[model samples]
Target: MNAGALVLVVVQVAVMVVLSPLLVGVMRQVRARMEGRAGAGVLQPWRDLRKLLGKETLQADGTSWVMAAGPVVLLGSSALVCALVPLVGTTTFPLVPDDLFVVVSVLLLGTVALALVGLDAGSAFGGMGSSRHMTIAALVEPTVLVSVYALSIPVGSSALSAIVEARIADPASIASPVSLLALVALSVAVLAETGRMPVDNPSTHLELTMIHEAMVLESSGRDLAWLELGSWLRLGALLGLVGSLLVPWGIAGDVTVPALAVGVLALALKLGVIGAGLAAGEVFLAKLRLFRVPELLAGSFVLAFLAVTASYLVVQG
Candidate 1:
């Protein structure tokens, strides 16, 4: 990587580290306000992180190396996925064919690692949560992959950089019916992937309904801190990927300082809109029952399939 790329990478990573908690805080505050309560400040997640870090970590009895290593691996994988995503106009690293597939796989890897660790601790809730998590993942992953592939069709490559570059090259393509359909499908996938409402409720702590939180109930102190931060970072990364693919406007294709700054601002604006939409959706919709999740995801799959079919027809026409 060149100096400019290196700088951009470092900035993006630092931004993810700092801004992840704020993103979580924003979601929490918005959710609270929607429910008619005076919401906590956007800095609340940061405060929670600080409190967790200051506490002592306790391990479960008979927990193996896998349990201890899970959080670190999860955090590392989250960071790696964030780095691989073309968040700010261009990728810091060179584009690799089929890398987008790898990105999705890495996310699954992290999720599985956390689930295993949860089960390793011998907590009934943890094991139950892990089982539920894998079930959701098995259903959700294909929808995400197919939906993203639908969007990638017009660009003729699965590489995120290629997709972004194609969209930038022809901004009008975003208005095409196929593109619109793909965006809709991807939007649903995003909500599902991020544990948003009508799919998974981020705020729910009830063991019967909780999937993500139940797995982490045994985690404490710095370990919990890392897991929480990783979740936020993963959210931001997924949002950034969607933005890059669907709304490539105002992204800087070059590496100049001014261009980088513009890219960053544009990215922030896109994320802000996404965050608001998520907040609004959560406000309006109730969480779906665990059994109903398959139907929701299957709907996304059909939409994605239609999107791909529509794109092919439009291109051929």
Candidate 2:
């Protein structure tokens, strides 16, 4: 409600929209170079979006309004997430604090919207993808909550902005066992939730192997554009969350023009570094089998549980 928070919200949304596609392109370029291929430039995702937006959208018969509504819902939810999560600044919204549960719920809204869109498509691949997507979602969401809850323990607040601010205030806590364990757990969950390697391949279309791609086979034109952009924003924002939590530096505690400018640069740097690292790491990895993904997620859950226990023990000690 204050000027700082209002300005930060606008800035967060604008930066997420503008940076997400570029982040995706950077990841792709990284992977391409690793694989010894001529890479599409970092501006490629923007080019693709422009092309998709200009094409006509097609819908099949007997599909409900979900076909039309789902993409909008997904994109809207992702944009809201960018606005709510303190990606570049720590100014908290008066009405809706950046609580971990609230952020995860908004993310779930987008996930559900995408699943419904897949189911509405009425193809075998779509149904299969939806089932798989929901299965992963069921596992990933709990890890996200529990891991972030661990981070919230020391600060005694679930608001992400507060947690980040606390980390900035106390640099030593960033190196604590609780913080490291929880961050690792959350990072794995982020990879799974965003359709990254070892969970789902963002670039693959092999019918038996694809999860996110299978669901979107039926969408075209602007519909597809919305879906792609929404997914990219989710990835960008979650990566920003990880970056902010892992290194809570340069985020403006009190929003000023100079501070905001520094925050934006810091965020862009973090996203690029993390995206490139992820891509480079994925080069040496293979997508896990659908059945094996549960084990990986379950392992992350155990890490989160340990982090929670460690946090409590540390507090007691």
Which candidate tops TM-score? 2
Q: Which 10-residue window in model 1 sums to the lowest lDDT?
A: 89-98
Candidate 2 achieves a global lDDT of: 0.93
Per-model TM against the reference: 0.94, 0.98
lDDT digits (tens) for residues 172-246 of candidate 1: 887888877877787787777767788778888688888888888888888888888888888898888878777
Residue pairs that clash (backbone atoms under 3 angstroms), model 1: none
lDDT of 1 at 46: 92
Among these predicted structures, which one has the highest lDDT? 2
Global lDDT scores for all candidate models? 0.80, 0.93
* Model 1 global lDDT (CA atoms, 0 to 1): 0.80
Stretches off by above 4 angstroms in model 2 are none
Per-residue lDDT of model 2, residues 138-225, tens digit only: 9999999999999998898999999999999999999999999999999999999999999999888697788999888888899999
